[model samples]
Target: MSKRALISVSDKTGIVEFAGELVKLGWEIISTGGTKATLDTAEIPNVSVDDVTGFPEMMDGRVKTLHPLVHGALLGRRDLATHMEAMREHDIQPIDLVIVNLYPFKETLLAGGSYEEMIEKIDIGGPSMLRSAAKNHAFVTVLTDPTDYAQVLSELTENGETLFETRQQLAAKVFRLTASYDALIADYLGKEIHVTDPERTTLTYDVNQRLRYGENEHQAAVFYQTALPTSYSIAQSKQLNGKALSFNNIRDADAAIKIARDFTDAPTVVALKHMNPCGIGTAETIEQAWDYAFEADPVSIFGGIIVLNREVDAATAEKMHKIFLEIIIAPSYSDEALEILTMKKKNLRLLQLDFSQAEVSKKEMEYTGVLGGLLVQNQDVIVETPAEWTVATKTQPTATQFEALKFAWKAVKFVKSNGILVSNEHQTLGVGPGQTNRVGSVKLALEAAFDKPSALTENAVLASDAFFPFADNIDEIAKSGVKAIVQPGGSVRDQEVIDACDKYGIAMVFTGVRHFRH
Candidate 1:
């Protein structure tokens, strides 16, 4: 018996050669409008659906393949007496192979299309034929993705027939293709037309890759997305170097971007360890930012990821080569900087992300795993500049101290909750973070300010991302000889905290905002 195959697609990749090979193997080629035209252009003899159905193609080529002759060939069972009898009465023969891809529904949405554009792109006869072919997978073979074409062709050439397993896999892909197509259409209609369709937002996506593991070795990890977009999703990146990304690497990189993105000034640097900013500072030059950040905590930033908001220069590159860091996420890197960095740390992950173009589109409510389920809450602990802040303190900070306070406030927001940071002139002296008590956090911040008056006066400016609910914390910080103070003053004892600052002659300014990250 001779084989029969049908080819119809909006994407005509590899279809002509595929049909030619099948025709050479004594298989009849059946196709639709543009598909048939393509086969004709290739000088491959083909039968159009109109010729098979004994009817003219009508309604702008939409009614060509919806006739009973086409579907009966796909749906009729080969074994049953009643099915065989009905097929003979209708002059129908079983279709052995089905090659089809739907209209450009997904592509239309991605191309900034409107409702009418999507509605027009939805394939009616294509889905009808696909479902007809996929449901009879035991008898009919279905092909949707062009990537599967070469595999199917190779299998047929090697064995002279496609395996049942191959047909099953293609059928599954057909369902997935149709399902994803509808999800895009529904999602678009819901957004633009406000179509209160309850079925719209339920999204389904394909897995792109699986990481080495999740947060722990015991857990499993898989990454997924609706589509591969250039600046968005991990799958879109070209992994130029480094080992596979762990869960912690992605999390810390995300934190690094959040802090580094906002600083468009001369040079801003942030060193992140375990999803918190271990050190951060801004300066008139990139080298200065690197110097200040390195001097902040040369110990804690040993294996942390560093993010620089400005292009790295040779001076900064020379400084970075001495440290053992995981990754350096920056906007760009000079040739001299690259040469220096690559020589020292060849395996280091160097990523040049578009800081100005990327941001979290929506505030994803954070989900932390618990015993039974998970804890969920909004993550908006980002701190802003002092110019937009309301100063509730009696004594205001000096102009120079105000800049240091804003820099500290921005960095501390990325730190763990109950965190504190102390800095002066764009360099952190000591940072106390993740401590339980407020006073403990204060001590952790000012613990390294020095015993000598010269060192204390030169590099001691205390900053709290929040307010001091009591004056005792102020007295202890004064003992560290913090020459200035900056906080979001909202406590009932704000006056007492102010009094302590006056007694020590410490300049204090409140931004009237608190940033607590947990």
Candidate 2:
């Protein structure tokens, strides 16, 4: 008996050559509509589905290959006597090879397609055929991706049949691809149905790349990307230079981008080390922002990653060239700037990301992996306005001090808890992160501020990640010459903290919302 191969696809990338290769192997080809046309145009011998199934496609080509003849051929059990008897009785020839891919539902939705058009693109017959072939992998070979075509052909040419292990692997890939396709459709329709909290929601991602190592050299990790792009996520960023990105580089660069995204009103620069922003600065130009950020903590930013909200020009690039940085991330860079930076340092990683094309992050979910499971939560992207704040001290903050307080507020939330941020106007003076106690963080911040006197410790403002449990942190802040402070006023010692602030002639405000980043 001659072997039979069924071919159907929405993506016709390698279908012609793939089917032609089957023809060269003496396997009879059975293809549907467009695939049959392609094989015909390529002068490949083929049998049309209508000829095999004895049924014409109907419902605008939606009913093709969905009949018992097509499925029975793919799902027949070659070893079972009863199944072989039924196949002979029904004159159903077993299909040895199946190649199929689904429709463009994801692409159609992303292209701003109409509801009817998107609905029409939801493939039924294609997935059904794939599932049938996958279910009978013990007696069949399945191919879903074009990248596997050459491998499958090589195996067939060498052995006269695909290996059992290769068939099982290809069958597994079919289910994975179909599962993702179904998930995209379900997610899209779930929104229209107003199913805010469906009992089960499906999301699928494909492996983007395998990294060198995880956070440490001992662990292994791989990056995955969503099938449907809903935002300009960092996973979609383009890396223009340097070696392959490690796990640590991705984490630190993500932290820098998150901070830079918050300052949409002006050009912002954030220098990060070990997932903490060491220095942050906002100015009218990228050059000034870089200058202020470098001045904020010249020592801490030695090997840090720098992220900018604006385009990097030649002037900013020249200044950056003088320093050794692990990475630089920005929306864009001028031709001259790119030349100077890449020419100056060969190993510096350059990443270009445009946040404007992204969806609002508040709608997305964040997941943290735990033992045997994951802890899922929403992102903390809420921005508190001045109208929501209350003054907590006897003396009100001056206009300049209040502006500095707000700047510090935004900066402190990104720090780890027990976190403290000290700033003077648009630039951060010092930052204290990952302390066990608030007073310890205060001491760390003040010491850092004192070390960089040019950051202006005299009237610097302090922002705490949470409520101060005692007035000791307040005393520590005053000792550093910080004249203004802002914290969530939920602690039992709020009045005591306020009294201590008044004793030091420091102004204070309560934002009402505590930013506790653990």
Candidate 3:
């Protein structure tokens, strides 16, 4: 009997050439619909599914290649006499190779296809054939990815058949592909029905990059990204220069981008280290923003990730080049800026991201994985204005103090829990995050802010991620000469905290919304 190969594909990349190569090797080709027409146009000898199954393709090509003759050929055990006898009785010719790829459901969903169009794009017969062939890998070869075509053909040409190990690998790939395909369809349909928390949930990601190691050198890690990447995401960023991003670099870059996204109204700069915002600044120009952010924490900014809302200019790049930064992310870079940044710092990763669709990007869900399960939540993208806050102190904040409080509130949201930030109108003076106690964070922030005297520090305002449980936090804030304070104001001792601010002549605002990053 002549060796037979089945081929059907939605992505027709290199399919004709692959089929042609198989034909040159004396293998009979079986195909369906467009694949069959494509083979015929290429003068490649092929048999259609209609001829083999004795059933006409129907249901708008949804019912093709699903009959027993096709599946039995793929699933029958060639080594078993019983299976062989049954195949002979049914006039079933065993299929030696199965090549298939599912319909473009993911592509359609990402393209914003209609509900009916998405439903139509889901493949039924294709996955069935793939699973059948994959199950009998002991006697059948399966190929779902086109990249495997060349290797399978080379093996067949040299050895007259694929190695058992090769067949097993291909079989595994088929199951993985089919599983991902099904998960994508299920996720899309689940959202259509407004099912936020289904009893069973499936998630999928494609490997974006394989890192040399994880946070530590001994651990291994890989970066996986969603099928539909968001515009403001670091995974979707285009690397223009420098070495491949490490696991830590990616994490810090993600934090930096999120913080920068919170301040889109002005030219903003965020300096992040170890997934914590060390300094953030918003100003009229990218250059000024860089200067303020750099001045905020010159020491911690070393080896940190820098994210900018506006394009990087030559002046900003020159100032940034003075530090031993790990990464720099920005919307774009002037030609001169790129040249300056990439000139000597070959290991510094430079990522260019588009923030035009940033508001849309905020709609994506955030995920956190634990040992045995995962946690899902909406991203913390809410922005509250100072006008919405209530004056919690007898002394209301001045316009400059209100603006400074607003900036501090925005910056503090990105900090770790027990967070405290001190800033003027345009730049952060100090940030104390992840402290064990609220007062500890307040002390750390105050100490840093008063470490040096500057005009900005004289009119500094403070913001907290959550309410201060005790008045000691207010006492600590008083030592820093911070003129205004902003906090969630939900603590039971809220009155005591307010009285302390009044005693110190500090203006305080209650936002009524907590922003605990942890």
Q: Which number leads on lDDT?
A: 3
Q: Write down the TM-score of every candidate.
A: 0.81, 0.96, 0.97
Error of 2 at 249 (Å): 0.6
How would you encode candidate 3's per-residue C-alpha lDDT over 1-518 as one tens digit per residue?
88999998877899999999988899999999889888899999999989999999998998988898999999999999999999999999999998888899888888899999998999999999999999999999999888898899889999999999999999888887888898898988888889988888778888999999999999999999987667778889999998999998888898888888778899999999998888888889999999889889989999999999998999999999887999999889999999999988899899999989778888888898899999999988776766779999999999989888888998999889889999999999888999998888888888888885677697799999999899988887787678799999998999999999999999999999999888
Worst 10 residues of 1 by lDDT: 228-237
Candidate 2: clashing pairs of residues? none
Best by TM-score: 3
Off by over 4 Å in 3: none
Residue 65 accuracy (lDDT) in model 2: 89
**Each candidate's lDDT (Cα)?**
0.76, 0.87, 0.90
lDDT (Cα, tens digit) per residue for candidate 1, span 276-314: 777777789988888778777778899999988888889
Cα lDDT, model 2, residue 39: 84
Q: Supply the global lDDT for candidate 2.
A: 0.87
Count of residue pairs whose backbone atoms collide, per candidate: 0, 0, 0
| TM-score of structure candidate 2 | 0.96
Model 2 Cα shift for residue 416 (angstroms):
1.2
